[model samples]
Every structure is written in C-alpha cells, then in structure tokens.
Target: MAQLLKMENITKKFGEVTALNKISIELEAGEILSLCGENGSGKSTLMKVLCGIYPYGTYSGDIYFSNEKLTANHIKDTEDKGIAIIHQELALVKTMSVLENMFLGNEITQSVITDDNEMYLRCQTLLKQVQLDVDPHTIVGELGLGQQQLVEIAKALSKQVRLLILDEPTASLTEKETGILLNLIKDLKAHNIACIYISHKLNEVKAISDKICVIRDGEHIGTRRAEGMSEDDIITMMVGREITSLYPHEPHEIKGEVLRAENITAWHPVNTHIKRVDNASFSLHQGEILGIAGLVGSGRTELAQCLFGSYQGKSAGNIFMHGNPVKIKNCAQAIENKIVMVPEDRKKHGIIPIMGVGKNITLASLRQYCFSKQVINEPLEETIIHQSIAKLKVKTSSPELAIGRLSGGNQQKAILAKCLLLEPQVLILDEPTRGIDVGAKYEIYKLINQLAQEGMAIIVISSELPEVLGISDRVLVMHQGKIKADLINNNLTQEQVMEAALKE
Candidate 1:
C-alpha cells in the first residue's frame, strides 16, 4: 500500500494555551487509523488542521498527500484533494432530499444549467457503494439517524474522496446502525480508501482499526497495531493510568419512596393520538438509583421528560411527593416541587453555549443570587459558581470561559453542577454519560453514588444496558412507551434486561 498522507510536527495554539503539541502521524492507502483519547484531547483539533479548518498559516504543520507537499487554505481546497470529514453532528439539511444533499455544493452542472438527472444517477451509484438501500429522492429528515449517517457517507463518496474522517460517527446511532456503519467502513477499506476514525468507543476502535493512535493533553502518546492493544491498554494510554473498573459503584442505603408516578401517559408532541409514554407507573426512593433501560424511542426519555415537566406534548399522571400529589405542568413547577432533570441532549437543553460556564451553572438558580428586583449579588453568585464547579470537578481553566469551549465530559459536569445548585430532592439524569469517555464515566457514576448516599432520589435513563445495569439499584425496562418490568438489580445481566424490554 502506498503512503496516502503524512502530518509532521503538527502544532496548534490558542492564545497562550497549546492545543496540539509537535504531534505527527502517517496513513497508507486502504488503512484505517483510529484516534483514541479522552474528550478535548486534541483529536478533533488535529483533524481540523488536516481539513484546513484552521487553515495553513494558523497551525505549524507539514502535510504530505500522495507524496506531495499539501497546503490547503480551506475545506474546499482539502475537498479538491479527495479529503472529506463527517462531523459528529450530521451536516445534511433535514428538509432536503438525499440527492440534493449529496450534490449540495459539488453539483454536476451542464453548461451552468442544473443537471438533476445526472446528479440523481451519481447519487444512486454512491448510495449503492455504501450499501444504503434508500431512494435518492427520499427526504433526509424522514430517515432514521443511522440512515442519515449513511447518507452523509454516501455524500462523501460522491465527492470522490480518497481519505475520510469520521468524528464520533456512532455517538447517536443504534446498535444495529453502528454495525452497518462499521461494516461500511470495512467495505470502504476494500475500495482502497483510507479512513481516520475518531470515537470514545474502544470496542469499535479495536474491531475496525489497522492501527491505534493515542493522544493526551495535546501530546502524542504512541501508535500501535490495533490487534496488539486491549481496551484497558488503550484507556491507560489515553488517560495516563489504568482504569481497573469502569463503574465505581459504592454502597448507598435505600430508603422510603420520595417520588412516585401513577398512570402516567404522554402524547406525542406533534401526533396527539400517538402515545409516547403509556400508563408508566414507577416509584423512586431516597438514597437509591433507579435506572430506566430501553431501546431508542422506547419512551424512557419521554417518561423522564414527563417527570421533569419538560415533555413538549400533553401528559397525564399523578406525581406524588412524600405521598402527597403535586401538580407540575411546567419545568418551573417541577423545579419548585423539588424535582429537576439533567436533560438528555446536553447541548440543546442543558447549557447555554455562548454563556460563561459560571453563568450557565448559575442560570437555573439565579433568583437565589439576586439581592433585589433590580440588582444581582455578583460576589455571592461568583462564590456559588466556583463552589459548584469544584464540587462537580468540572475541568475548566476559568469559570468565565464559554461552556461550549469545554470538552463533552466537562460540559456534562457543568450541567450537573447547574442542576445540583437547585438542591432538588428528586433528580433525574437522561443519558448522562452518552458521549463521555470511560474515565469521565467513572467519575459521573461515582458522583451518582454519592448523590444517592446523600439521600437524593435519582432516576437515570440510558440506552446502554451495561451502564443501566452497572449503576442502578433497580432497573425498569420499557418497550414502546410501556413499562414491561421492574426488577431489582442484584446480579442482573444485560440479557435479562434486554429480554424484558423485548418481551410482549
């Protein structure tokens, strides 16, 4: 195999902070290289440099493509050199057709007249190459997340890409969808196209990559053959220490019921007739962790939303606090009733991106920091923000930094800090560790245990059965908006939870 690309002495800095050190890497045709690191470990930064998102003059790096000196001033320049990147957030316009998105910018033009027929034919071929059996004219918004991901890949293929960069591609994909994507990458490899795969999932990394490169804090740790590294080894390299256990579960006493939902039913936001959550009844006890386990769209999230009073659609249920029924028609009402939730989509619902981390942490409890109707106690607010950040161990250079600039794990921690500021009796976490790294996951799990120990009733919702089983004192399995089973998590297995979820 010929050398496809080389990045030598890559170094990037922001202000006085060095984001990427003198890091270097190489890739050959048809080879798959997986970049392993904790969140904010410079994987995305390196890719941005390669794709010219940082541009040539901004970063000190020598890129060689096809044995030629490659200096791209922008993404378009890199795309012309057969380089493409698929971001974690799918870039396709949801309302447009697959064919339109495929040839969005690089359309096949016939004398400046739009050639839909030619684009349609090429789009079909590209979809075929990716083994996606979807019509080119199909609306992208109508497709599932997995299918949308494939469309993004098919769109990349249409660009005649020789090298592809996938960033957290499977973060939002289902298990089956992820399998299809992994197989698709292998198929791409067979076509002699090189790939740079970046993900927090070590299992997938080991299964797919020809070699694995680990980086930490802007420095290259090492690059080794994927077959030679275990998940633990990769983790150790990435975090600079061996994580013997992924779940740091601690003993916490379970007490009497703190919150209960009886006959809960939630309607779809748009389709009023469609019930997203149906007659879901459950109880959460103080000093106990309750895990909701279900497949995507199984209504676990809807149930949490209903509990938090954030469900967009109408919901009917009897929520009791200490056996007294309480009315919670809105998020403010829920918060006032001592029930708060850390939302599933952190970026969308949890944090204010442009706001400072301190401001985001204090956003929910700002009233407590106000001295009067016209004034805010800035010193008091600052003190509380610092305390919350420290308590959550939210890694940030300063509380004034924009929360969006932080890593996924740090952002999640900041959100947790925000929720903790409210001092709610019953706390709900939806997909709390979805996109975080293993090290960060352990910390979150530990924090959950601590919260439970402090006599806080907690409800956790997760798609990963291992996570649900690992942390929950009790597990509730839901299927198609219905609670199928409530089982104690004593020596529970994934098979048992999955079986309950699929059971009629």
Candidate 2:
C-alpha cells in the first residue's frame, strides 16, 4: 500500500490554550483509520489543519501527500488535491436539487456555460457509487437525514475525492442508515480511496477501521491495529486511564410512584391530524432510574417533551406527582411543579451560549435569589452559582466565563446543575451523555446513580442501548409512537431491547 497522507509535528494554539501538541498521523491508501478522542482533544483541529480550514500560518504542521510536500492555503486548495472533508454538520443546500448540490462550487462547464447535462450524468454516477437510489433531480430538503448523508458523500465523490474525511457521520443516523453508510465506506475502500473516520461510537470504529489512533488533550497517545485492540483498550489510551467499568450502577430502594403520566397524546405542530405520541402511560418511582430506549423517531423525545410541557405541538396528558394531579400547560408551569427536563439538543435548548456560566445555571431558577423590589440579590446569586459549579464539577476558569467556552461534558454538567437548582422531584434527562467522552460518560453515570440514591426519580431517554441497559433499573422500549414493552433491567442485553423495539 502507498502512503496517502501524513501530518508531521502538528501544533495548533488558540491564544494561551494549546489545542494540539506535536501531533503526528499517517494514512495509507485504501485504509480506514479511525481517530478516537475525548471532546476538545484536537481530532477536529488536526483535520481542520489538513483540510486548510486552519490554513498554513495559523498552525505549525507539515503535510505530505504521496511523499510530496503539500501546502493548502484554502479549502479549495486541498479539495483540488483530492482531499475532501465532511464535517459533523452537513454542509448541503437543502432547497437545491441533488444534482445541483453535488456540483455546487466545482460545477462542470462546457465552454463558459453551466453544463447541466454533463453534471447530471456525473451526479447520477456518483449517487450510484454511494448506493443512493434517489433521483438526481429530487430536492435535498425532501430527503431523510440518512439519504441526505449519502448525498453529501456523493457530492464528495463528484469531486473525485481520494481521501474522504468523515466526522461523526452516523451521529444522527438510524441503525439501518448507519449500516448503509459503513458499507459505502467499505465500497470506497475497495476502490482504493483512503478514509479518516471520526466517531464516538467505538463499535463502529472497531468494525470499520483498519487502524485506530487515540489522542488525549491534544497529543497523540498511540495507534494500534484494530484487529488486536478492544474498545476498552482504546478508551484507556484516549482518557489515559484504565476504565474497568464504564457504568457505575448502584442499587437503591424503589419507593411509591413519584411521577406518573396517563393517557398522554401529542399532535404534530403543523400537521394537526398526525399524532407524534399516542396514548403513552408510564410511572416513575422514587429512587428509580427509568431508561427509555428506542430508535430514531420512536416518539421518545416527544413523550418526554409532552410530559415536561415543552412540546411545541398540542398535547393532552394527566400528570401526577405524589398522587396529586398537576396541570403543566407550559415549561414554566412544569418548573413550578418541580418537574424539569435537560433536553436532548443541549446546544440549542439547554444553554445560552453567549451568557456567562453562572447566568445559564441560574436562568431557570432565578426566583430563588429575587429580592423584594424585583431585584436580584447579587451576593446570594454568586453563592448559588459557585456552589452549583463545584457540585457538578464544571471545568471553567470562572463562573463569569461564557458557557460555550467549556467542553461538551462540562456544558452538560452545567445544564444538569441548572435543572437541579429547582429541586425537582422528577428529572428527565434526554440523551444526557450524547457526544461526550467515555470518562465524562462514566461521571454522568455516577451522577445518575447518586441522584437515584438521593431519591430523585430520573427518566433517561437515550439512543444508546448499552447506556440504557447499564444505568436503568427498568427499561421502556418504544416504537412508532407507542410503548412496546416495559421490562425490568435484570441482566438485560442490547439484543433484548432491539427485539422489543422491533416487535409488532
């Protein structure tokens, strides 16, 4: 195999913070190299440097392509050299047709006129190569997320990409879609195109990667052949610690029902005739961790939102706390009733990015520090802010710093702290640990256990089956807007969850 790409002695710095430190990596032709790291560990930074997003002078690095020194001043400079990157956020124009999006910037030209026929032919070929069976003229917006992902790959193929860099490609995809994308990558490998696969899901990495490279805190730890390394080995290298156990499960006494939802139904916001959640009924007991496991669009998030009165659509449900009915017409009402939710999309719904960490933490429960004349008690607010930061182990220079400056894990912890400030009886965490590192996930698991020990009824909705099985006292499997099964978590496996999810 020929050497395709090599990044030597790469070091990237932002102000006083060093994002990457003497990091070195190499890729071989037709090989899939999986880059594994915690959030903010310089994996994305290193890729940005390679793809010219960081540019030459911004970072100190030497990039080589086929043993030739390469200098890319712009993204187009790298793209012209057969290197293409697909970020975690899709960069396609949704309103445009697939054919148009495929050849958006690098359009095919026939003597100064846009070559529509030639571009369409090439786009069809690219789509076929990616195994996307949709018509080239189909609008990108009408396509599902999985189909849109394939369109992104086909667009890369249109550029004759030799080295494909995929960052968290399957993060928003379903199991079936993920399988298709992985198989497409394998097919690309068969054609001798190298790939750099970055993802938090270790099982996909182990299955698809030829070699696994682990980096921690901006430095390359080591690389190993995927055949010999287990997921635990990769975790140890990434976090610089041996994690014998990922889940810290603690036994707690289950008491009477703390919260209950009966005959819950939610209608779609725009399409009033459609039901997103249908007649769902469940109960959460004191000192219990109830995990909701489902595939994408299984109505898990909708159910939680309806219960918390945060759903945008119309909802009808009977919510009971301590055997007394509560009317939660909105999120404010829900908060007043001591029911809070840490939403799944934390970046958009959980935090105020521009605000200080203290403000974000205290945003929900500001009434606690309000004085007589609609004034905030500054000294008391500061005390509560400091206490929450310390209690949640939020890593920040100060509580006054912008919440967005923190890592994903710390941001999530801060959000958890914000929800806890209200002293809620029912804590609903939706995809609580998504996009966080393994070490951060262990911490969150421990925190959930601690909360359970403290008699907080926790409802955890997650897409990761292992996480649900690992943390939950009971697992509720949902499918197609309905609760399929409620099973006790006693030696339960992922297979059982999937079986329940797939049941008719």
Candidate 3:
C-alpha cells in the first residue's frame, strides 16, 4: 500500500491553550486509520487542520498528499484536492430534497440553467454506491438519522472523495445502521479510498481500523496495529495510565422507597394521538442508583421527562415522595418539590453557552442567594459558586470564564453542580456520560456513588449497557414504550438486559 496522506509536526494553539503539539501521522491508500483520544485531546482539531477548517497559515504543520506538499486555504480547497469530511453533526438542509442536498454547492448546470435530471441521476448512483435505498426526491427531514448519515456519505462521494474523514459517524445510529455504515466503509476501501475515523466507541474502532493512533493532552502518544491492541491497551495509551477498572463501584446501603411513579403515560409531543410512554411504573430507594436501559426511541427519555415534569407532551402519572402523592405540573414545580433532572442533551438544554460557569451553575437555585425582594446577594452567590466548582473539580481557569470554554466532562460536572444546588431528593441523570471520555466517566461514576452514599436517590437513564450495569443497584429495561424487566444488578450480564429489551 502506498502512502496517501501525511501530516508532520502539526502544532495548533488557541490563545493560551495548546490543542495539538508536534503531532505526526500518515495514512496509506485504502487504509482505515482510527484516531483515539480523550475529550479535548485534539483529535477533532487535527482533522480540522487537515480539512482546512483552520486553514494553512493559522497552524504550524506540513501536509503532504501523494508525496507532494499541500496547502489548503479553505474547506473547498481540501475538497477540490479529493479530501472530504463528514462531521458528527450532519450538515444538510432539512427542507431540501436528498438530490438537492447532494449537489448543494457543487451543482450540475447545463449552460445557465441548473440540470436537475443530471444531478438526480448522479445522486441515485451515489446513493446506490452507499447502499441507501431512499428515493432522491425524498425530503432529507423525512429520513431517519441512519439514512441521513448515508446521504451525507453519498454527498461526499459526489465530490470524487479520495480521502474520507468520518467523526463519530455511528454515535447516534442504531446497531443495524452502524453495521450498514461500516460495511459501506469497507466497500469504499475496496474502491481504494482511505478513511480517517474518529469515535469514542472502541469496539467499532477495533473492528474497522487497520491502524490506531492515540493522543493524550494534545501530544501524540503512539500508533499501533489495531489487531493486537485491546480496548484496555488503547485506553491506557489515551489516558496516559492503565485504568485497572473501568467502573469504580462502591456499595452503599439501600433504604426505604424515596420516589415512586405509578401508571405513568405520556403522549407524543407533536403527534398527540400516539403515546410515547406507556403506563410505566418504578420505584427508587434512598441511597440507590436505579439505571434505566433501553434502545433509541424506547421511551426511556420520555419516561424520565414525564417524571421530571419537562416532557413537552400530555402526561398522566402519580408521583410519590416519601409515600405522599405530589402534583408536578412543570419543571419549576418538580424542582420546588425537591426533584431535579440533568437532561440528556447537555449542549442544548443543560448549559447557557454565553454565560459564565458560576451563573450557569446557580441558574437553578438562584433563590438561595436572593435577599430583600429578589435582589441577589453577590457575595453569597460567589462563595457558593466557588465551593461547588471546587467540589465538582471543574477544570477551568476561573468560574468567570464562559462555560462553553470547558471540555464536555467539565460542562457536565457544572450541570451536575447546578442540580446539586437545588438539594434534590431525587436526581434524574439522562445520558450523563454520553460524549465524555473514560477518565471523566470514571469520575462521574465515583460522584454518583458518593451521592448514593449520601442517601440521594439517583435515576440514571443510559444507552450504554456496561455503564448501566456497572453503576446501578437495579436495572430497568424498557422496550416499545413499556417497562420490560426490572432486575437487581448483582451478577447481571448485558446479554440478559438486551434480551429483555428485545423480548415481546
């Protein structure tokens, strides 16, 4: 195999933060190179530089394609050089048809008029190449996430892409969709196209990658053959130390029931005729971590939202606190009743991007620092904010810094701090460690155990089965908007949980 691309001595910095330092890597034709790193370890930054999102003069690096030095001033420049990147966040106009989106900026034209027929034919060919069975005339918004992902790849293929870059392509996809996408990548490789793959899922990386490159704290650690490297070995390299255990489980005493939900049902937000959650009932004991496991769209999130009074749909449920029925009409009522929820989409719902970390942390419990008719006591707020930041170990230069400047882990911790300020009796954490690194996940697991030890009833909704089993005292599996099984987590296997999820 011949070398297709090479990046040497790459150093990228943002203000005082060195995002990447002297990183070097190479990819061969038809090879799949997987980039493994912790959150904020510069995996995306390196790719941005490669795809010219950072441009040539903005970073110190030498990029070569086919043994010739290359410089790309814009994303189009790289695209013109047969390099295409598909971001984790798919960039497609929802209202546009699939054929239109495929030839968005790179349109086919006959003289002065746009050639819709030609573009449609090309789009059909590209879609077939990616094994997507959707019609080209279908609107992008009507397609599922997996189909939309395939459309993104078909769009990239339209550019005559020689080097394809995929960042967490399967992060939001179903297992069947993931298999289809991986198989498509194999087909692309057979056609002599190289790929640079980045993902937090080690299993997918191990299965698809020929070479694995590890980076830690903005520095290149090493690259090794994917065949011999175990997931633990990759984690060791990415975190700079061997993590003896992925889950730091600490046992705590379980007390009497703290929260009880009976006969809960929720209607779909848009489609009022359809139920998203169906008469789900569960109990959480004091000092116990209850894990909710389900497939995507299995109503786990809907059930959590209904319980927290944040679901944007009609719901009927009886919630009990200490065996007393309580009415939670909205999130404010839920919070006032000593219940708080850390929502699943942290970036969208959990934090204020432009606000300082302190303000975001205190947003939920502003009344604690209020005095004399809604006037906030600045001194008291500052004291509490500093204490919470230190307690959560949020890695930021100062509390006054923008919350968005922190890594995903720190942002999540800040949200956790926000919820903690409310001093809630029941804490609902939905996908708490979705995009966080392994080290950060361990820390979060530790924090959850500590909270349980402190007698706080915690309900964790997660897609990762390992995390559900590793941290929960009891596991509740849901399938098709209903609770399938609720089992104690002692010696429970993922196979059992998955079986419950698939069982009718």
- The collision pairs in model 2 are none
What TM-score, computed on C-alpha atoms, does each candidate reach? 0.97, 0.96, 0.97
What is the TM-score (0 to 1) of candidate 2? 0.96
lDDT of 3 by residue, 164-236 (tens): 9999898778888999999999999999999999988899999999999999989999999999999999999
Write the residue-wise lDDT of candidate 2 on 418-483 in tens digits.
Answer: 999999989999999887778888889999999999999999998888889999999999998889
lDDT of each: 0.93, 0.92, 0.93
Model 1 TM-score, all chains together: 0.97
Model 1 has an lDDT value of 0.93
Which residue ranges in model 3 land beyond 4 Å of their true spot?
none
Q: Which stretches of model 2 miss by more than 4 angstroms?
A: none
Off by over 4 Å in 1: none
Kindly give the number of clashing pairs for every candidate: 0, 0, 0
lDDT of 2: 0.92
